[model samples]
Target: MQDKLSKFEKAALLLLMLLAGIFGGLIRYFHLKYGFDALGLAVRGNRHAVILAALFALITLAFAVVIVLALTGRLFPKDAVAVGTIGAPTILLSALSALAAAVGTIVTLASAVKQLSVWGMLNGILFFAAAILTVPVVRKLSVRSDSASPIGTASLIIVFWSCFRLIEVYRTVSSTPSVSVYFYDLAALISLILMFFGCAGYLYGRSGAMRVYLTVAAYLFFGTVSLVGKGGLCLSALFSGAPVAMANVTDVCVYLYGFLFALAVIPTFFAPRRADPVAELIQAAAEPEESGKEEPPVL
Candidate 1:
């Protein structure tokens, strides 16, 4: 394979990717707090907010198109990255995110822990059960251990996106549909699709690992930004003595899933240091009938 990108092009691309991440994180923060349509009629309609929404919509749609095209076998991203195994930094981040999330959960529930209802119990059970099932994701990244099954990961991804983001999008569209809300609807739907692909790709760990990494990063970035954006709206409403558009439990779960995606990134980037397992995965991915031959790593 040839490295076609000039140094400047590569640098520019990295910067753009980083910016996208920052913006997405902001949106996630807000979205989690203010709930669906929090950014729709009130925010997206504002002239200043237009720039924010426009940038996010552009990023979401752009990545969505690329991933969809690639999935359909029509095109693939040009930039090449070879991730051979999961790394310590990724595991550390994952651990930190999970621990922080746990502490946050306990604190929030402390006030009402004794009055927990069936809904709360079910939600907690479902959330923790899903988290437990994904434990092997990062743990096995270093050794190419098949402890985490793709099907399990897929189920979790689909369930979360469907139950949370997709339903929220639906509720947004159910109301009066402005141009901005329509745009929001489309962006939300596309992002859910991207999230699904990104999560599924993490377990594949063969070729296109860099693509998986970028997709997962983009998904988490969007998730983070949405949560932050909603939080911004909710806090303002709280101070002004207005009803806050908050879904505390659900929003936290969504944020934790974003963190999970961040952890899954470990396997997407760092491959096993040994080539044997890498070769086996690649062979199975690329050609099962052909003789097992090692292909040079992508640089």
Candidate 2:
């Protein structure tokens, strides 16, 4: 069982690394196609800001890789590090991603309000709150022995948000959606479906396969959507000679959320199973009591 679990962890880690590479490649391709500077100035229009953000993202990814390696015993001996130590990076990453999302939502909401788009403002606010709340839940999951509840809850929230965003984009593009935008929508829809099943499996504490499936699906779709959207924006900006919109910045932040969430949930998939208290309680209640023994007082 331990060996099988270790294999799964390694596989998941490899998939994540591959996805990360693909995402980075797409970003670079867009920059090159758009004739952006090394700092993505043409795309973001703020060299210093883009540079800083890019640096931060790189650091975060590196940290994530290190944590996963340590957890897998690739960076150290099998017993050298505690699981909690491996989990620390996940907590930090979650907090940082949540912070980024919150900031992006605020910036986006302000702009939307200025334009008097009620729906936009509402969506931004809703997503903002959801993103912020995810931090504490993820933090709790990291240190706690039993993570099913938090995992299920987070999965549901993310699925809802993804579906909401998908619908909003679909409505906006109903008239004449571009191929690239349609790809983005498809990615969001895929993520929603995967997360739904993932959440269900976690809540039920069954279907380990479903959990792994969701992890891969989430990571793949997350990378794909971000790449499609950002790549499209870069291409458009290139042709139009316009700077990247603040919306693109927001998208970057949103992309980080997916990456962080994937990292946060991976360990849970490999964790050893424990007895469910509720199940134990139900069994105890159902069992027949000894005829001669006095019944214990109910708590």
lDDT against the true structure, per candidate, is 0.50, 0.54
lDDT tens digits, residues 201-299, model 1? 545544344555555556554554544454455466667776322434344444555545455554444344436767788878878555467787999
What TM-score does structure 1 among the candidates reach? 0.58
The estimated TM-scores of all candidates read 0.58, 0.57
Candidate 1 lDDT for residue 297: 100
Per-residue accuracy of model 2 over 245-284 as CA lDDT, tens digit each: 5335555556556555655655544454445578899878
Worst ten in a row by lDDT for model 1? 1-10
Best by lDDT: 2
RMSD of every candidate to native, in Å, equals 8.5, 11.4
